[model samples]
Target chain A: DVKVTQSSRYLVKRTGEKVFLECVQDMDHENMFWYRQDPGLGLRLIYFSYDVKMKEKGDIPEGYSVSREKKERFSLILESASTNQTSMYLCASSRVLGGNSPLHFGNGTRLTVT
Target chain B: AQTVTQSQPEMSVQEAETVTLSCTYDTSESDYYLFWYKQPPSRQMILVIRQEAYKQQNATENRFSVNFQKAAKSFSLKISDSQLGDAAMYFCAYRKGSGGGADGLTFGKGTHLIIQP
Candidate 1:
């Protein structure tokens, strides 16, 4: 079984403050992703990393960035937290293509920005 | 571009009964993958089942099964013997079969399932 762990299960930050969300996977998957889930909108990709030091912007990348310094770790950074940024954030990891592997997700971190 | 849609926002099923959730998608690609994910109140997303577009046979896992209609571009999930633990938010997702350089998944507005005792 693949295990994905998030650094924080819940977080609260003030407006204009910077915030960080961390994710780690034990399976050493090559692909890691950060997504924000909202009501009626579902999960929208914020950023993804294919390999160490390689990152790509997803559909919704504004005000957010990601870091992948190691194969097992991925981090999401919120440049400036705002009330609108309050939502549930999810992290997922999967093996590279050619294999029929689905993403394994961590218990999401619910962020609250005041 | 690919898009996934779940028409039903909420569904109710009695324990030990069966319920089906509808999902439709639009994409020009001939080969892709479809998935149904269940997120419980704990906020952990779990893969319920998956179906490959190229395969004509529907995919099934234990009490969960999928009705895949390629011609209609429809993929529906059927849950038999619904239990209290089956109550969750179900999401339908689509992704282009590998080789596209870490392609991201497109997801639909999830349907909330409720199990009535």
Candidate 2:
């Protein structure tokens, strides 16, 4: 079984604060992803990294950035958190891209910006 | 770019009955993969079933099975004898054939399944 561990299950931050959400996968998967999920709107990809130190913007990457300093770790940084940014963020990892690999997701971080 | 669509935002079914969730996708590529993922309340999202484009046979997992219409570009999940535990948000996703460049699942808005006892 693969484990995608998220640093925080629930987070609360003030507006205009810089927030960091961390994710680490035990499996040495080659791909990692960050997503924002909201009611009515499923999981929207924010960022994805295919290799260490390599990242790509997803469908919605406006106010977010990602860092993959290590193979097992991927981090999502919110440069400036706002009330509109409050939503559930998910982290996922996959063995590789081509093998019909299903994403293994973390428990998710419910972020609240007030 | 490929896109997935789950027209039904919510569905309700009785326990011990069967329910089907509809999913359709648009893609110009001949080869790709479709997936159904479930996210329960306060639980991590998990894969329910997956279908490959080239395969004629549909994918099934226990009571969960998929109705794959390649020509129609439609993939629907049918759960037999639904249980309370089956209640969750089910997402339909599409992934292009693996070669290089862009690689990641394109997801639909998702359908919320409600099981009635």
Candidate 3:
């Protein structure tokens, strides 16, 4: 079985504060993704990393950035937290793209910005 | 760009009954992959079933199966003998084949499944 672990299951931050969400995968997958899930809108990709030090912007990448210093860990950074940034964040990893590989997702972190 | 659509936002079914969740996608490419992912109250996304465009046969995982209509570009999920544990948010997703530049899955808004007692 593949295990994806997120650093925090729940978090709260004040407006204008910076926040970090960490994720680690035991499968050593090459692809890691960060997504924010909101009610009615479903899950939207924020950022993704294909390899160490390589990152790409997804559909919704405005106030967020990501870091992949190592193969097993991926971190999502919120430059300036706002009330609108409060939502459930999910991290997923896959062996490689363009194959039959399916993404294994973490439990998710629900962040609240006040 | 590819887009997935799930028209039904919410659906309900009684125990021991069957329910179908509809999904439609628009893509210019001929080869791609379709998936049905379930997110329960625990907020963990689980792959329920997956279908390849090249294969005519529908994908099935035990009580979970997909009705894939290639030409119509529709893929719907059918859950048989619904249980309380089946209540969750079901998302429809589309992914292009190996040769495409886009590697990630494009997901729909999702349908919330409610199981009645």
Candidate 4:
């Protein structure tokens, strides 16, 4: 079974604080994605990385950035957390894209900014 | 750009009954992929079922099946014998089958499914 482990299940941070959400996959997938879940908006992609040290911005990537230094790990960084950024963050990994590949998601991290 | 729409924001069904969640999408490309994902009360979300645009056969997985209408761009998920565990937020997503690089998935708002016991 493919497992994507997120470092924190819940996180609380104050405004203007920097936050780091880590995601590591065990299946050695080549594609990784970070998404934020908000009420009525569904899961909006924040960033996606196709390979090591490669990244691309998604629909909502204003206050977020990503780092993929290795094949199994993808990190989402909130440069300056705000109250509006409080939402559920999800991490997913897939073997490859452009085919019938399905994304395997990790137990998401719920972030609350005060 | 492709867009997905889920008309029903919330749906309720008694246990052991059948419930179908409505999903419609718009895409210019003829070949693509549609998916239904389930997210429980917890944060973990998983794929429920998937249907290919080119295939005429509707995809089915156990009690979960999809009603794919290509001409109308509709993909509805029908869950038979709904159980308490089936209560979750269901999301409809669309993705282009072209070479995957920067083109990610486009997801709809999602529908909340409630199972009444």
Candidate 5:
């Protein structure tokens, strides 16, 4: 079984603070993704990386950035956290983006900005 | 750009019964993949079933099966003899054929399933 690990399960931060949400996958999957989950909007893609040091903006990428320093690790950075930035963040990894390659997700990190 | 829609925001079904969740999508590409993902309450999200556009045969996994209508661009999930554990938020997603570029899954708003005992 593939395991994706998120560094924090729950986090609380103040407004205007910089927040870092870390994710690491044990499997050497080449593709990684970050998503934000809300009540009615579902999960929206924030950022995705196909390779190390390569990242692409998703539908909602404003105020967010990503870094992939290693194959197993992908990080999501919130430049300036705000009350609106508080949401459930999910990290997923896939072997490759073809065929029936389903994404394996880690336990999401719930961030609360006050 | 592709868009997935789950019209039913919430559904209720009795245990040991059958329930179907509807999903519709719009895309210009001929070849792509569709998926149904389940996210249990306060739990991690997991893939439920997947269907390839080329294959005419519907995809099934255990009690979970999909009704894929290519012409209608509709994909619905049917769960037979549903159990309490089946209660969760189910999302329908679409992904373009893999070749290059950002191949992230385009997900719908999701349908919340409730199992009544």
Candidate 6:
């Protein structure tokens, strides 16, 4: 089975702090995604990378950036954490984009900004 | 932009019974894919079922199935013989057929499923 690992399961940060959320997938999938899961809004995509060193902005990319210097690792960076940034962040990987390639998600990291 | 809607914020069903979660979407593209994902409490989210737009038949996985209506732009999930472990926050997602996986999925506000003993 494919496994996506997030470095932290729970995180606490103060306002104006820079935060880094790490994700690594064992299956070496080509597509990696970062999403923020909230109570009512569901999972909103933050950023995605299709290849190493390549990234694309999702619907909600403000105040967030991503780095994919390696095939197995993708990182999400919060430039300046704020109270509004407190939410569950999820990391997912897929072989490709299509019906045959289903997304496999890692246990999310719950971030609390104080 | 594509949008997905899950009207039922919460639903409860007895064990061994059946329950359906509703989802509707609006998109201008003709080809795309629909999916139902389950996120158990404090666990990783997983794909439960998926349906291709071109396929006329609905997709099913074990006891989980989807009612995909292409014309109406609705995709609902039906779980039969529900078990206690079936409780979760169910999300409906959409992705365009193209993009080779570059474009991320557009998800709806999830429906929380509760299993009653």
* DockQ metric for all predictions: 0.62, 0.68, 0.64, 0.70, 0.68, 0.64
Could you tell me the lDDT of residue A72 within candidate 1? 98
| lDDT of candidate model 6 versus the reference | 0.92
Q: What i-RMS does every model get?
A: 1.9, 1.5, 1.6, 1.4, 1.5, 2.0
Show model 4 residue runs off by greater than 4 Å: none
Clashes of 2: 0
Scanning candidate 6 chain B in windows of ten residues, the lowest lDDT window is B96-105
Candidate 2 chain B least-lDDT 10 residues: B96-105
In candidate 5, stretches whose alpha carbon ends up further than 4 angstroms from where it belongs are: none
* Leading candidate by DockQ: 4
Which tens-of-lDDT digit does each residue in A30-89 have in candidate 1? Answer: 999999999999999998998999998989999998989999999999999989999999
lDDT of 2 at A47: 91
Q: Candidate 2: which docking quality band? A: medium
- Residue-level error in angstroms, candidate 3, position A73: 0.4
Give the Å shift of residue B62 in candidate 3: 0.4
Q: What is the TM-score of each candidate against the true structure?
A: 0.97, 0.96, 0.97, 0.97, 0.97, 0.97
Comparing to the true complex, what docking class would candidate 4 get?
Answer: medium
Tens digits of per-residue lDDT, candidate 6, A1-114, equal 999999999999999999999999999798899999999999898989988999888878999999999999999999999999999999999897555467899999999999
lDDT of 4 at B90: 98
Candidate 1 lDDT by residue in tens digits, B6-100:
99999999999999999999988887899999999999899999998889999999999999999999999999999999999999998877656
Candidate 1 vs 4: which has more DockQ: 4
**Candidate 3 segments exceeding 4 Å error:** B98-102
TM-score of chain A, cand. 3: 0.97
- Number of backbone clashes in candidate 3: 0
Give the clashing residue pairs of candidate 1, or none. none
